[model samples]
Target: MPPSLPFLLDRTDLHLAELHAARLDGDLVGVGDRFSPADIAGTVDLRGARELRALSLLPRLPVGLVVERRTAAWLHGAWAAPPGPLELCVRSDHRVRVVPDVAWSVRQAVLRPDELILVRGVLSTTPLRTALDLLRLPPDDRYDGRHRSAVITLLLMQTSGRERAAAALHRSPHLPHKQRALDRLAALSLR
Candidate 1:
């Protein structure tokens, strides 16, 4: 049998009275879980953005939500900024309630089983998919050419270069955004 996953305590993990007592005593710091000091400072290298992203997300991500858009790119090494409000994708059937302070946004989409991957134990869009998603944004919504170029370079490196990116675009040619992805890829190649 596969080894069982380590228990990560969330609100539901504790009985109501215990949760309240832990919070009242300052033993539990965050809204989601009663995280110990060690869990707060994981083995992740403190200097890297990935570690920051993981730490910020591990406590806030809602059950069944998948990270996407610029957030996914940030997680995949395409951007250096700290993650802002959580951006997520969920199937049409899922219900997500508004979260205070966290400022989450969600997009409903038809997700193919293969479009998602895990990053630091969080489910996120693949690098290629994230690139494609970025390309689909209207010009004004997308980042500058220089940053986009960096994103393309990093994502391409993560996915073993151009072939896989090309294949992903080709596989979804019918998407209205395919040409946008092509344009972005072409622009990156010319740089």
Candidate 2:
């Protein structure tokens, strides 16, 4: 067996010092600072806590929303220019109201509760919902025809994994929009 690596944080108490400092300040500081093993002294292991903090707090906040390519790009801070419109995918079971300032459209579908996951702090619709929603968007709402087609195709593939896309489509008296969504999905499949 290879020789065991030195327990730098455990042996040197460096992680404890940093946590104490951060707790006193009520914020993390020098989070990315590198310290040589020589900089720490004592018998204390705080590496696990340090690792947890590094894993949890330093990254971009997760947005609990079922997003498409455009929304994903925007959420990741990757877009240098304004996106034309925001397309959001939501479950047919949830009540959603779009805010006025956002230029957006919705694609509605059934999402299994088990598939929904928390992003950041909000609940996001599942991948299956994302795909079905893409299929339900109007052609005019999708500015780039090729990109739109690709998203729809991807959603259809996702749909195939679950069951026939048509299996979820049904007339809804409570949800007239769902009927429109089903019709749109059917129309797209034909083309």
Candidate 3:
């Protein structure tokens, strides 16, 4: 028999056949491209947006990649299902060729030192930076309206999220969709 999988293990060494078998046995459920214990999802274990499993997500992400956008938001307890393709940002000077199953959303950005944080050895954008990125994100076919709305709502729920985003917005006058984001924040404030 194949070696038993760990409770929340979803690493490069995992085999497709093993994942399929675990799914067939009702012991695991698919999350993005990984398999997680089926019981933990809806049971008492699941507490709000920060699933216990999410703590491991950052470390499990491929090394040297800077996670950002919806993926970073999800990592920061947004809990809204992130894009199927892991949203990755590489340094403007670095070059990488990723071939994720659904294709990764990769970009080259020069993130400021204050905009990044290391979580469990994986690097990602700060929550505020992630919020800003999502707020200004151009619409994509990968995310539907509901998903975006849900992600936005969860973002606003973060500590001082609304205030911080507004302050940061005024600092950068050249950003696209500035007025639209202002209006959105105003409308969200009323609710």
Candidate 4:
């Protein structure tokens, strides 16, 4: 079995059939593809469970891809469920290629050095960067429906998440949707 952090079970810990059997046997309860011991399931923090669930995907994907956008927000304990087609980002100048036969969606983004953070050994965008990315997304885009809640969660999670994101938007060199991002941040701040 692969090394594990506290309160998480990965595929390497058991085969799918074995995991399901354990769940059916009332020994474990699953979140996405990972599981927590059944006895502690109700006591574990839901947000932390979600974070661990999202992190489980990391071992299944290639080594170099950085988690971003909705997925990162989920990792920050900002979403109720794991992201579908698991979103990831490759730096604009990075050579990482998307792996096939995996359930993930990849985008190329220009990330600043400060945008990344390592959580439980998983590399992902910081909540500020993740929220800013979602806020900067075109509001009219069809796929952005859940982005509002995710962005709100990301911003509210840290004491200065909103301020940091607002500052980043203000200092941006290219302003494709700077106003939109600021507006969204302001609206969330009022609530």
Index of the highest-TM-score prediction: 4
The prediction achieving the highest lDDT against the true structure is: 4
The sequence of per-residue lDDT tens digits that candidate 2 reaches over residues 33-138 is 2222322222223433233222232232223334444443222222222244554555677666644434544566555675464444434444444444444555
TM-score of each: 0.64, 0.37, 0.67, 0.77
- Global CA lDDT of candidate 1, please? 0.63
The reply for model 4, stretches above 4 Å from the true place, is 1-7, 10-27, 40-51, 143-145, 189-191
Better of 1 and 3 by lDDT: 3
lDDT tens digits, residue span 1-191, model 3: 97654546465646888877987899877655566677764463323224443444655465567888878777666645656577888877667665554546677886788888776466878777776777666555344454356446655666777888888789887877777666655655324
| TM-score pick, better of 1 and 4 | 4
What digit string (tens of lDDT, one per residue) describes model 1 on residues 1-191? Answer: 97532324454666867756765676543322233333443443533335445554766787778888877766766666434666787865667664444567777866676778766677887766777777777777645764576457556555455567767778875776678777777667523
Go through the candidates in order and give each one's C-alpha lDDT: 0.63, 0.42, 0.65, 0.75
Looking at model 1, the pairs that clash are: none
- Root-mean-square deviation (CA) per prediction: 8.0, 13.0, 4.7, 4.0
For residues 1-191, could you state the per-residue lDDT of candidate 4 as single tens digits?
A: 98544566767877879888988999888765687778667675855665566556657566678888777877777766667878787888789866665688887888877889877667789888888878888756543547888887777777877777777887886867889888877877425
Which residue runs of candidate 2 sit more than 4 Å off their true CA positions? 1-112, 115-123, 138-140, 143-148, 159-163, 171-173, 189-191
Candidate 3 clashes between residue pairs 3 or more apart in a chain or in different chains: none
